[model samples]
Target: MPGGLRHLGEGTAAALARELKEELGLDTDQLPEPPVLRWVQDQTTTRPGSTEPFERLHLIHTLNVPDSIRSRIATTEQDANDTTQVVWVPLAQAAALHLYPAIGSVLTTPAGTSIGPVELPPMVDGTYRWR
Candidate 1:
């Protein structure tokens, strides 16, 4: 996932889609719509030496990779501001690994604020829901 300071006035899904387009150079139309949104709050010291509080909403989406283009993904830096390299991990393996302790806790409690946990409803069969 790409990480950077986000500008105000933009919604989370729009910001994530823009980031993917700018950072991966992939056609937005080819990407799947986000099915879930997970909000996280973080406090950090900025480059200008000021404490800043920010909320990150993780937009989760799955993409179907065609065999032809699979090997060519992640070949370039489409966004200059992007600082992290993207990697693809198999879903089954990812779920089996022991991730950071905080990662698991985030789903149970809101971070850095008093907000409560955001529960995502399960999807029903055959419906297109995009955010």
Candidate 2:
């Protein structure tokens, strides 16, 4: 999504939960324990359509989808604005796409300030980690 931080009020798990419920109408209880939370920083100074200074610390939450629920889930407008787009791409293809570098070093060091030319992690089974 373009303005994920904005959509997530105060940037808390509960807020995210509320957002998900309002946006996608997905029940958080259907999700598994301890959703994957990744911390990222948007170091870029110049962003499109904004005069306010930017702060990093973008947290991305990855929720597991049950096979049954996956089939029922659909992207809403909120999801689109909060996320770029929801696509069903294979892990191999997704891995080949250029993703933000900060996503790469999450398991290790914080990735340097850069975007693009980075491969995303693979999706295993039906669960995929979000960055």
Cα RMSD of predicted structure 2: 10.2
Where model 2 places Cα greater than 4 Å from the true spot, the runs are: 1-3, 6-11, 42-44, 49-52, 78-85, 98-131
In candidate 1, the residue pairs with backbone N, CA or C atoms under 3 Å apart (3 or more residues apart, or in different chains) clash, namely: none
Provide TM-scores for the models.
0.44, 0.53
* Per-residue lDDT of candidate 1, residues 18-93 (tens digit): 7766776655456454323444432222223435532233334335556455566565566665445656666555
Candidate 2 on 63-92: residue-level lDDT in tens?
A: 666767766655544555555444555444
Look at candidate 1 and tell me the lDDT of residue 100: 24
* Deviating ranges (above 4 Å) for candidate 1: 32-35, 38-72, 80-84, 95-131
